[model samples]
Target: MSGSSARFSGSTHLLCCLGAVSSTIVIAMPAGALARQAASPPTLNDPSFDAALPPLDSAAPQPAAPPVPVAPRAPAPDPELIQPLEPIGSADTTPPAPTAEQAGTGDATLRIRYETTVTGLAGFKTDAIEGDLGRQFRALSALIKDGNKAANAAQVKARADEDVQLAQRIMKAAGYYDGIASSTIDLVPGQPGVVRVTLSATPGPRYVLNTITVTGAPPEPTKIARDSLGLKAGQPVDAALIEGSEANVSLQLPQFGYPFAKLGDRDIALDDTVHNADYVLPIDAGAKSRFRNIQTTGDPVFTVSHLNVFPRYKPGDVYDSRLVEDIRQALVATSLFSTVSVEPVKTGVINPDGTEAVDLLVRQTKGPWHSLAATAGYSTGQGATATGSYTWRNLFSPEGALILTAVAGTQEQGGSVTFRRSDAGQRDRTFQTVLAIDNNRYAAYKADTADLSVSLSRTSTPIWQKRWTWSLGAEIVGTNEAGAALTLGGAQPRITYLVGAIPLLLGYDRSDSLLNPTKGFRITAKLSPETSLKGGKVSPYARTLLLATGYYPISPSLVLAARGQVGSIFGTSVDDLAPSRRLYSGGGGSVRGYGYQQLGPKDANNNPIGGRDQTEFAIEARYRFGNYGIVPFIDGGRVGESSTPGLSGMRYGAGIGGRFYTNFGPLRVDVATPIARKPGESVIALYIGIGQAF
Candidate 1:
């Protein structure tokens, strides 16, 4: 029995040992199994315990064996609260998950290192990025941080290249190229992902003026040297200035009649220190001289002695084409000549003293002309009119001319005799005398008048490089009149007076042509103050007239023109004055759309009551078609007593006209409609004339 008990105890010990091993396996193995498989593994595969296994304890436990088999105590709760209950398989294998510290510490440390490296770049000064650079920096920084290292590097290189290109562009913009300053961009090394770039520029050499002198012989040396020298001491030497100076000097010589002067050569020196330059000009003043001889040829109607009447220059006179031109003008003014030409025959050789001799040759055209003209027109102020005139040009002598004109119908019935002499050799003057008589009756008023006048005038044109003409004259006048008075029974007295006066006239005209003035001014002033040493009572009479006009070219085919005129009569008895001395405005030449003399103060019978003073203004725009032109014009004017009329007593008119060009002049035809008039006045009228009104 003792031996039986020993074996039983041993068995009990064995059981205890088994239980401990099982416990350890369940505790440790479940944790690993859970990691491998989400559910608990199947029960361990071991030998099953049967009732027969109790044989070792059968002898000892036989007496105390309970009537019922002790129910197996529930397996101790699993040490791993959650374990894989399914069998392990190849699909369950997986890597161990990372701990929190490993992920957090590792990523944080990497970011810190990257930021530190970026911030530590030596040349990367944040303050240096002020405006656009600051924006670029922000963009670059964000790109680096976002793990775009390749793009960041590309952007950095591209920006560096752009900086270099911009610098080059600036240099080019400043007109500098092919210089050391435009070479390259240098990049300074820095921490990883950071760099600094700098651009250095080298400037080009500056040239200075070395020597400056006048290069060419100018017509007026003093004036040309003063105006044409383009360089000053210590100034920059520019090729353009040198060229311009040379050209200006060359051009200046021609005005002084030195057509052969030239700028021979020029030299310039550059100074590096002060950035200055100097220039030297070589001038060639060639051949100063005079006309050697004069020759004439052509269809000469006049002898050399007669042609000598228009001598341009005497022997040994300075050679001047302009003087020769004056001679040509004198010949043309004679009216005896139709065509004239004067030219200098240039000799090839220059004198030993650098002087030249030229020859003058004259050509002329003889003329014997007869002209017959007839005209018909209607006027509201003058009624219908017809005129015929006959002219014998260059009649008797080369200097003699005569004209006979006759007029009939409404405006006036008149006859005229005129004789003229041009280049009469009386101090280079033109002489003309006229005898005229006219009977004029007005449509507006029952006024009829007759007048006769004899006048002699002398016109002189001097050589002053200006277009000017002056005239002095004396005249005798007489008048007869018969007209109705304001009242029915009162008959206007027939009054007459004889007066003589000397008139002085001054005129300045500058235009491309007399017929069509494109760009210039014309001014005329006349003063007729009677002198006491005359035929009858000098009739204390004085008349003053002023006219000014301007033409502006808008284009080759368009022009703008303006004119103003004022006339006044003083020291005159109204009744004793000749009808021609009265001032009247309102006509094609005054206020365009108005009848002749119809715009001024009027009497009860609508007669243009003559006034002592008159003023008129006109503005016109003309469009040219070949040689002809069309014009639309506006005019304003007034006529009244010098003392009583005010500014409000003015009339205005606007109209359109056309100009046809002929060899003699431009013939103008205008049709105008009165814009403002009295109740009984006509609205439209027509005017025909030759040349500009002014």
Candidate 2:
């Protein structure tokens, strides 16, 4: 009761203060202020009131400013610095979008980026299948080579599907007919935007031939053809081998008297259980024939009768393609035709041996039969020389030729007319007659000579090299030559000599090439017997020479070659023989750094006197690099005073040469210096010519 009475007394005191403040506010306001406020009030539609406040729809839409583009991320890093991601087939296989770095920047950006991987291959088969798959896909894949211009993910899948078929075909070609090939498009992790195309193959046991059969032929002929195909029962059944072997059967049948033989479609039976294939080759062994008459057509370089000489087989001989090839080669050797073909044509005439007679159709297109040629050579002592010739080949037809030749040189000049008949009376034989005159000026002698010679020989040409060759020739000459005086103080006189000579040469060559020999050896022997009439006295003399050359190949590009020559003269005094007829050595083809004919005896004034005998030797190392070659050579030779060649007084020269090889021949340039410099010999000698210096 006391707390309630104290609270009421406090409340009554606060109420009395508020009632006094309320009576003062009523008294302080101007009279009628509340009435005036109620009479003039602001309205909701007033412009001034609305202008002072923001609109209630302030959150509504508004025009936007242009956006700022984000720059592409910088190129990731050097590709080499980045390790290759593991194959997607293994662990993480989720494909990531290609980054700017993976896809390439700017215009070089690939529509699709991927790498090719071949899996499940073994042995030699791996390389083969991989190579084949690479070739096929690179040429045909829309992904790898970007073969499809606008390539995309869909195209990548499509290409992988097509590759499966292509890989299977390749497996079959490699003799795995039961192999299964599959392809997968895999996403490589870490290599963003790049895909991996994995080609996997399970090559079943390689198919092999279980049986080989020849159809449409007799037992004897079938055996012959089957053996020619070179297919064995245990050999792999490769498509390439089968196709090639089938072609071989047709070719070989013609060689075995089946002139009209041909091959038909092949039949193959695959046995999956044993992985074996039974191959049947159907050969159309047309008529077995014998060679009958050979008919000639087209431009005739040789008459029909003359052409018969080329064939190794005569009429009525069994049809052998080899013989046909031989005849064709013989004609080609003549260099008379641009096009040559020899084919068998059925004559509808049957032989008694149940073989038909076939005539050969020989066709030819004539090639150029006339030519003009020129050659140039230079030697230190011999000076420079140029020779030109015009030849009318086949002037009389059947390989008869007429040639006019002229030689112009610093120390010599000559002209000649020659008539040469090739294949004269026999194949590889030639008959030639030459009429010439020459004037020679040299340190050894000065001579003006007239010569008439006839020769029959079988010599090697650039195209054909005969193992055995021989030459028989006769020559008559009238020469006026100057020589040293008989006495030391006497006058040097010019003597007129008449000479008649018979020469015989025999040669055997086992070398690989005539002009550019790389292996084997060659040997040649020459003997010339001469009768000379000088100062009203007749003298008989014989000159002999022997030459041998050998070549050894140390490597495919290097050859070691050596040659030796020995010559002698007998049955004549040195004073009685003409200087031009004496044996001599030195200069380009002999002792290199020495003057021509300057290696023998000398006169009182130190002029060369030539020699009665001579010996020469040269060795070279020929090394080749592509179209060029280099040769380091050494040459040694001596000219002797006696009738027989001796090793004493030999002069040696060493040289290095460079060769520029062309389709026609090697162009040669050599620089040499005498090993022991002589009084009058040059310190250095340079020789330029064509062909190897042999």
Candidate 3:
């Protein structure tokens, strides 16, 4: 019984060992559901086991009994087969393993420090990434992991290279590359990619003018110094100034008769070391020649004696073309010729002394040409009007013009004749005589006046480009008046006053153009005091008037203009003063927005009341079109005691007008509407005239 127990124990131990091995395999290997197959009863089979009991020799050491096979293995399991499969345990599952490189030398606690340098960034505000270094590093690491280290480095390098190039370009653009600092870039390595770059700039060079010299035989060197040569010491150097100065010198030479003079050998040099520039100019005053004689031949209407009066050159006089021009002007001034010419005669030497003499020639236009013209138009105030004029141009010679005009109308009925003669060598100086008589009703007042005056007047040109003109004249004026109270019904007496005054006029005109002044200013001052020498009242009354106007071009074709006029009578009795001396404002020339003579104070009959002292203002906007124009305007004015015209005293009106261009000038037609009027007053009044209101 003891031996039986031992055998059983051995069998149990073998089964336990087998179980342990199975458990290990199950833990390490994959598992799945088991499949069942039909089982056959085991045949106590293997002959090898059955015949394995062989006798041992006495000399052979006895071996330990082998553990009894657990239920005797039926057949060794097929090498490819797994028996009794079971489910896998969680402990045996794990992720795929990493490669050797990623393990990083197998050092678990390694520390990496990284540095970064960025380049080729435009407007790289530090605030944009003040604390974002980690993000940049992560992006770089990803690039390495994606096997694009070389490509990414190239992209970074490209940007940095572009920035470097841009820096150079910017320096050159500013003209400072020669003085500024250079730039560079480099790369650094760490846990993340890094780079370093530097940019530096320096100041550029400055240039100064070292010398400036003028070399030319300028006309009247003193005058040239005063008019040209706008240079000074210690001024900034400029190449343009050299050219400008040369041109100025050339301009002055011609006025002095050196037409062939010219500037030559001009240059400007720049030196870097001294930071200076120099200018040099040379002038050549070629050959000089003088006019020896002058002669002319043409269709002549005047005799040789008449022609001799207009010679440009005289014996033993210096030759000057300007003098020839003066002589032409003199002949034209006589108003006796239509055309004139002066030519240099090269006649053979007279008296065998090589001295040349010249002959003068004069031409006069055919006379007896006459023109008679009449114009008719309608106006609200005048109802209807017609005017006739007769002109005798070049009556006896080209320089003579005679004019006769007559007007018959409900507002104005008058006639006049005038003859004028211009002087030689002068543009505005003229000798004129006039005989005029006018009978008209002006501003509800009636007056008949006659005047005969002879005068010589000269006009001076602008001063300092201020556009002011000065005129001085001497004249004798005579006057007579009748029907002074015919319209006022004896309220004002029928007084006849004759007086004379020596007048001096000062005028300024700043209009952009004489034909159409859209911008600038115009001012006129006239003072005429009576003198006893003319056998008139030394009434101690003097007249002074001032008128000013201003214009502004608001647009290419539109202009805004305004004007003001003020006048006062002093040193004379009101009765002795001529009606023409009376101050009147609201008229065609004064203001178009109001009816002619309809502005200012009114009379008891609701008609316009004229005044001796007047003030007026007007504003208008003019718009121009294809050879035509239109204007919308406003007018305001007052006439009464210069100081006491009260706020309610002024007259106001608004109107619009159209213009048409003619050979003579622009013709104007306008209609004005009064803003405030008495009961039964007309709503509008009309005016017709020529030229701008101002």
Winning candidate number (TM-score):
2
Q: Write the per-residue lDDT of candidate 2 for residues 349-441, one digit (tens) a residue.
A: 989989999998899899988889999999988899999999998998778899999999999999999999998978889999999989998
- Candidate 1 TM-score over all chains jointly: 0.53
**Least accurate 10 contiguous residues by lDDT in model 1:** 7-16
State the number of backbone clashes in model 1: 24
Ranking by lDDT: 2, 1, 3
Full ranking by TM-score:
2, 1, 3
Encode model 3's per-residue lDDT on 464-508: one tens digit a residue: 133656555444444343323434444544445555666678887
Which RMSD does model 3 reach against the true structure?
28.8
Return whichever of 1 and 3 wins on TM-score.
Answer: 1
List ranges where model 2 is wrong by over 4 Å: 1-122, 126-170, 179-204, 483-493
Model 3: residue 167 alpha-carbon error in angstroms: 46
Candidate scoring better on lDDT of 1 and 2: 2
Each prediction's RMSD over C-alphas, in Å, is: 30.4, 25.4, 28.8
* Candidate 3 runs further than 4 Å off: 1-287, 290-295, 299-388, 391-402, 424-427, 459-493, 510-512, 531-540, 572-581, 643-648
